[model samples]
Target: MEFTQLLERRRQRWTRFALLFTLFLVFISGLYLVVGEVFISPLEELSALEEQLILQLRLPRLLAALAVGASLAVSGAVLQVLLGNVLAEPGVLGISGGASVLMVLVLFFAPALATPFGFMLAAVIGALAFTILLVFIAKSMCLTTTRLLLVGVALGILSGAVVTWAFYFSDDLSLRQLMYWLMGSIGAASWYHHLLSLILLPVLIWLCCKGSLLDKLMMGEQHAKQLGVDVDQARWQLICAVSILVGGAVALGGVIGFVGLVVPHLLRLALGSENRYLLPISALAGAILVVLADLIARTALDSAELPLGVVTTSIGAPIFIWMLVSHHDSR
Candidate 1:
């Protein structure tokens, strides 16, 4: 009887999550179809330009937002579990910063190789460098959660300084390009950006399935190993996956911040920290959040669009500070 009741409760819990996911899916559809400067009313007839605008511009951009948001959120959740730190994330942990810095260097120094494909490669290389270093240090040094966070932050700061330094030597045109990229726009979103998201889908599935192992790791490395988990292998797999996913996001969206930090954190607070649910739900919620943020970025002002990064940071900063304060209080 108890076992039956437990199964029933699990069913009900999953049902609730399914409903929330559906609602968010509907929200994203609404944003994608109708929520822009020139609304494409589903019920109304459209002109050629209007149809072209939706197909050529808005649709791709919305898809890009969804892809970037989901990738970052999943990466963040995985990192939080892998490191056992609420604050560990792709952006805050220097994955995005690393990508940004290397992409900048490539753009400035190797103009011939600074094409979209080349930049993506550089971003991946940079992201891998930092993520691998962190994973290595954490495993080798047995760093505390707080110490790990500090090291990540220090790496991010160093990356930021390099990105800033690149600005000084760049010409007017390059400066304009760099500034736009740094500000994080979906303005360049295209059908090619879809490729990045498609590559990440299998990776996200793998990470979600590893939730059980992560749960075991929460008990400690020894506990996870004793439970038959290959602790080192799983950890390295997760690190590589995060670097690829986060680097793809940066390559597609240009160093957009805080989606990783905010989405997983917020979902954990609302839905509890069960990785099975948290991982997938965070992906959906992240899609909704970024799509909505992009809508606001486009429609917020009379003549100019806000940077998507700025919108995210404005929301994420306060929540992040609250987490820090609460964490301190608990300690």
Candidate 2:
């Protein structure tokens, strides 16, 4: 049948895209490891100093970039489908805000616990607490989608207020460190952060598998119900999954923006909104973007490093504006 042939062609196209994406990811990852302030040749043997730089300094940072990027992108993709809004992303849910508040508190009151591992733990705890609050409020009040979004906004605002007060009270040294963190950076990343990836990997796989559920939900609640989907349970399942994914990412890399917001939208535009393709490809694309952005952040300035979030926002904001203008023109 002609219909079957059309499906086959579409499948082939996506297969090609996936293959190309994988190759591109590999290339950039290698580039990230080799090209930094001190460039080392991958083809040739390295000095002891080069080996230390690559192993101790760059490798851990590279891994963090990949994990954080992939996690944020997949989280964003799932969120857009769940909220039925193309603009929805992990930050809009207040998960990152919660993580930020806790991280600030640790730095302000308990600087002794402000080590890299300690901050990551604080972030995860804060994100998990906020997620629980959102779930409870949503379940008890029986909130509609718009109402739920407003609740999340309100929570984010509350967290921001608390952080502002902390800023007002903190001394000069803490303030500088806090500002750097708020802007986001993986320059301090260490091998211990790799433990967070154990949490990230399983969640990523689970979310990628939920593409079928997302497709069913896309049609509308009643339609999804007719398709034997339990709408309530699926919604909660997705919320919890997104909470963990976003939490782990924030914990690992601070509040790096735009990766979650822009990566999925770009993929959807290019590949179509089929969650099966969109979810996995978003992960790959997100990893590539973060790795490349980190590369730029470190090497862009000779004396001082750029913030990771600043680099991503600088790159993503323009593309986002163009996307908005293009959508308006199309309409």
Candidate 3:
């Protein structure tokens, strides 16, 4: 009878998960059809101009946004689990900032190599450097997740300084490009850019397979090891996977922040901290949020498109403050 009940519960859980995923997919498809400077309806379409706009432009941009969103959210979920911090996110922890700095340098100093592939490589190197530093500092100082966030902020500040200096010496065109990149815009997305990040979907699957290990790690390093998980190996693999994910994401969509932090935290709050479910669900939710945000960014104003980061940060900042306050009150 106990086994029967357990199986029934598992079936229910899967049903709910499937519904959630399907709802998001529907929203994405619906939004893709109607969002932009022009309105498109899936119900009726027979214009070559509309066909060109939808197929040539909007589809690639939407796909890139989806890929970037999923990558950032899953990376955020993994980092939060690894660090035991709900607030752990690539943008918040300087991973994206580090990548941004490298991208700027490459754009100015090596314009010939400033292709999508080139930027992806540069961003990966930068993200990996920050991730390594983060792991080293956490281990050496034995810092709690909350305190480690301060270190993350310091790294962000350092990256900001570099970006500022780069801006000071750059030309007008360079400055404009840098500003757009830093603020996050998917306006320039193409099929190649989408592929650059979407190709890393396998890495996401590999991370999902490690969900059990991450759940164990949440108990503590010693506890994880006792559970037969290789703590060191898991940590390296998780961080490296995240760096690759973030690198590709930032290369495709620039340094969009808070999707990672907000999506996972919201999921854990609504459901439970089951890493097995949280990671993939968070990926889907993140994709939905980014697509919705992009739609708003493009259509919110008549004269100008808002920065993608601006929309996300505007929405996320309040939730972030609420989380901090909730943490404080709980303490």
Give candidate 2's TM-score. Answer: 0.87
lDDT of 3 by residue, 160-179 (tens): 89988888876788577767
Task: Choose 1 or 3, whichever is better by TM-score.
Answer: 3
Instruction: Score every model by TM-score.
Output: 0.93, 0.87, 0.94
Q: Enumerate residue pairs that collide in model 2.
A: none
lDDT of 2 by residue, 150-226 (tens): 78778888887888788877678857676686777888788887888887899899998989899999999899999
User: Clashing pairs in model 3?
Assistant: none
Q: Rate the local accuracy (lDDT) of all candidates.
A: 0.81, 0.82, 0.85
Clash count of each predicted structure: 0, 0, 0
Predict model 2's lDDT versus the native. 0.82
Candidate 2: worst-modelled 10 consecutive residues by lDDT:
84-93
Quote the RMSD, in angstroms, for model 1.
Answer: 2.0
On the 0 to 100 scale, the lDDT of residue 30 in model 2 is 90
Candidate order by lDDT, highest to lowest?
Answer: 3, 2, 1
